[model samples]
Target: MAQDEVEVLVVGAGQAGLAMSEHLGARGVPHLVLERDRIAERWRTGRWDSLVTNGPAWHDRFPGLEFADVDPDGFASREQVADYFAAYAEKIDAPIRCGVDVQRVQKNVGRPGFRVETSDGTIDARYVVAATGPFQKPAIPPVVPGNAKVVQLHSSSYGNPEQLPEGAVLVVGAGSSGVQIADELQRSGRQVYLSVGPHDRPPRRYRGRDFCWWLGVLNKWDEAAPPRGAEHVTIAVTGARGGHTVDFRALAADGITLVGMTSWFEDGRLHFASDLPVNIANGDATYLRMLDEADDYVARNGLDLPEEPEARVFGPDPECVVDPLRELDLATAGVTSIVWATGFVSDYGWLQVDAFDADGKPRHTRGVSSEPGIYFLGLPWQSRRGSSFIWGVWHDAAYVAEHIAIQRSYLAYDRAIRSSGPHLTADTSRHNQDDEPTVTTTGGSAVQVERAAGAQLGER
Candidate 1:
């Protein structure tokens, strides 16, 4: 088959890739987006029915598109948000190849392009954008034994309480998904137990202002100016990440018993840290204090107030108690369901590229990866204030797109030099940082095979 060529190739058609494709198309850059499934397929399939965006609708939009007729304080349901993304792709007429699973992507070492092999065909492009979301993989805890009869499902697989067997349910992980799922299960009349961890629990609203409003007012979302490595940096947690703040107090008010962090699971029962509530409460206090300081800083900085700052507290019941190292035996406790709302992991094994660091994260400055003509968007904390959020990817996308354009211009200069004659030597330094062979691949055979394949393609 003849090789398909494009100026840019995007490896995912989700929010980030779609946004990049939209921007690239608007700029008249030739690009093609490849998605393994239909656009927004994860959101449509992976989320539970009760799933609603934790952040408000206004904060959930991508660039050049807005969630229409939605209340700023109201969260968009999973279906609604998915539809919005579908509409976004339609609006832009993005050149997306849906259902095309990319098997591998490797640099054309001897050439100025990349070789992308997919289920449909092979694509060679001048640039590749890894817009596959950060949460492409779910992180399942290892504490649960494989032999247990208890039904284990990640928050991504949970759709509703009805999916659980008859009996009480123990929802593990005190993050937003765990708490929210626990609340949903309890409201469905299932006796629910939440394994609380060190987490922040702010109200959905503060002083009649949306929590998001305050987040913006205090620059909590302004991750750009934050002290590097600060854990308090706000992340955009819409869609699968759920909202940053879950109504834990409200869940407790509805009679869901909060327990300590899960230590381990044996015989289908979950063990918890006896002092779980204390840890949760302490973390809650720290968050409140941070918010208070943020409020004060905003006021001191002469920032206009959205509303009068109100005294806010964290956690549901200040007096809630938890036993240290207590075991909640699911068989004895009659809890039949275990929902792991733990978190996500980024698994990029499919992108057979040598640009990642030891931690498996793509080595990049801004969105520019160590590999030339390769970029990443929608990374956690990629930019200031919710840069990984659907809305936030726009800034990174625009910046990266502009950078790509500049690199394209430089490539033109290099091409002109090459076309002029053998008198000019290639300035190898112009290649990006990945050109430096810092570390060899873990699999020498795989690297050699890739190099051999690249060599064969170059010979073509």
Candidate 2:
């Protein structure tokens, strides 16, 4: 068996792993990035054909590399995002071993580091960074009967309306993906029914600025997590239609039937929760809360941002919300295909270390796992709400890289601290102070990864 050794091993070469690789490389940390398939495979192939980023190109970017020809306010198509990551990888000269599947990672019994088993070989790495990202597996519920006679697929596998059987399409889960797919199907002359569950409806643009700008100026992305009980509530926004406010009622008016959450399928019919009205009210409440917060923020800071009156006003509820569809005979409704825009669950079953909870969630604080010499990245609310995105991941990766550099410089395991000057500090906030996500080094050249980031507006 072929085997090799590196000081550090990075698993997965998605946005997270690539960001980690560049930071570690800049810090002179001997690390190898291993990818099971291809770099940014999730973005390149795991999404729908018409999918666009939920954030504007300006804010949804890595540090230092402004998109060459994209509109700053326009959202990037999935292909463009993949290309950007590819370009960034080429520019940084990331040390990635593509097609190498990491099988298991475990702590060495007699050694102080970890034993990583991969398809290529096993490696003895002093540190391991699991940057496989949060969306490891599709979280499709088993509510649909195993023997149901209909074409059904997870949103990750969905390509377009033409990919489905020629009949009414039932799109479940009214999250970002759900609503977008539902609207698209309806426009394509397909009778579409959307199963809307609890969600947070934020405007695509508010107060003469893109919501991304508002999030930055108001520090909303810096929020640690959502309010209690709404932790998993999907943020309903879209970059589809050149980026517009996500309104269920507008979709309803467009002939897409809005239904309640799918409850069960039995007794020769599909049952739905009678909570459509409640769901609508909850989403509206959140929507209003966000608008009010923005208003207060502008007034508090004396900013001259224009007011959006239409935001404060609301029209009548949709007919489905007023009188929710509680049950439906699939044949009578003419539903022939189902698109499960359900969520995802992180897969860490291969991790032999006990760095995770009983529920399989990695136990970490700001990417630093509870177990020594282990770290996890690209998790939601890892350090902040923005951690899962590129810019956020860049900062988080820097912090993790800084931690690794600090450990190497100060600990210098089995040896004395070899003449230390100014050590590296994991200052995540210091980087956030800049408009474009720029690295701010607080130590020697070991972590001097800063590049004067570009903020030039784009036009795609």
Candidate 3:
């Protein structure tokens, strides 16, 4: 009914949004951060009881604080991480509106700002920042056939092996999440069937040192470097079991039966890979090659490194002869549950802005977008290999805040000139000319064009 004004509006008060809010607050930027639930609700509610961080504690910290004397190599439990995030918000004194769900954001007509409509009310702001993460949606593969008898649940909903139905549990998707869930099920005496797929495998540690130590030594984590093509770039796949690596041999040693990729599930029969071991071996080789390439690059770059002590490589023993599939049936194998540790997707239906690309991903360059004053942070692969990591979001958050300050300075100058009167027509004309549209080359005969328009002029 009435207009509420703010300098900036940040949607989602998770790690990304909180980081952005901290930066803005430190710079004295007047802003409000809206969260759909209490801060870090996803981590508190969505994660399983045994869920420990894949990243090391040292690397899993938010901006302005560390995990506090915890084991650097040890993984922080779900609760610990969630509490740490809560403390982070408190430490920064971030002006977060908890439990405020933003419904939509659209360009304001006849005004020099955007209008954000939330469940509570509407707020007018000069800028909007969508800090919602890629994990906004859970991706359940379409190929998974329905079985009313089989209790099905995405990895997000699964908290422990107790939640699954009684029988041999088939865990689909051999990524990090899949492997971890499979291991958990087997440990709980459930017959676990792990679906093998194309996945990256690396040692949890090399030469007795943490794998992340190697990443740092090699400078592979550097964000300032030019973009290496997708093929050359290595990312930390979030759900991978060993953090950076997958140790299938360990799973086998613990009596977990690996299965082929699930072709389809029908009539209570979960048909999966017949050649599970071979597929697992192939996947391991592919990932090892990628890691070797990264190692070579480090050596070629003459990066200094520390000598690591020897460590045992995790793999299946040559003497171990276990059937990959059908080795243990759910009913006979004492398996009571299944957990789907598949991947995630992004959803931004709440925001009414046309800032997303064709793929439905937010369009941003170093946190700045084509939509003026709208910024993004903590995105996967935003500016570097570690952009999405808890430790790395700070770098992006600071960069975005700096850009916002620059823009604010520019806006203040323009406002001052307008209030000073019409004697400076030449300056105003030059400013207007600078905002004119320009043409650029497209790939083919067509051309891509953009106006250097200012948001102060309202939607064009």
Best by lDDT: 2
lDDT (Cα, 0-100) at 1 in candidate 1: 23
Candidate 1 lDDT (Cα, whole model)?
0.71
Which structure is stronger by lDDT: 1 or 2? 2
RMSD of each: 8.9, 8.8, 7.5
In order of appearance, the predictions have TM-scores of 0.82, 0.90, 0.79
1-460 per-residue lDDT for model 2 (tens digits): 3778888899989999989998998888889999998889899899999999998898899976988768988888888998898888899999889999989998999878988898988888999999988888998888877678878899999999889988898999999999999999999999999999999998888888887787887787899877799888998999998999888888888898889999898855789998888888889888888788889999998989887898877777778778888898888888899999998999987778979898889999999999989999899888998996789999999999988886675444113213433332333443544333322224353323323422211211
Would you list the rank order by lDDT, best first?
A: 2, 1, 3
The candidates, ranked best first by TM-score, are 2, 1, 3
- The lDDT of each candidate is 0.71, 0.84, 0.68
What is the RMSD of candidate 1? Answer: 8.9
Please name the candidate that would achieve the greatest TM-score relative to the true structure: 2
- The better candidate by lDDT, 1 or 3, is 1
lDDT of 3: 0.68
Q: How close is candidate 3 to the true structure, as a TM-score?
A: 0.79
Tens digit of per-residue lDDT, candidate 3, span 1-460: 2458899898888888888898888777789998989898888987777777767887778646888745777788777888888999999888888878888888888867798888878999998888886578887776545544456678888888667766678787776567777777788887666777655555666545465666676676774553433332223233334354566666766776666666655544556656666665655665566457555765787756543322234454423324545333344455445566666777878777767899887888977987886888767877877786787787788888877766665554355457854321221233353453222111111111123443232223
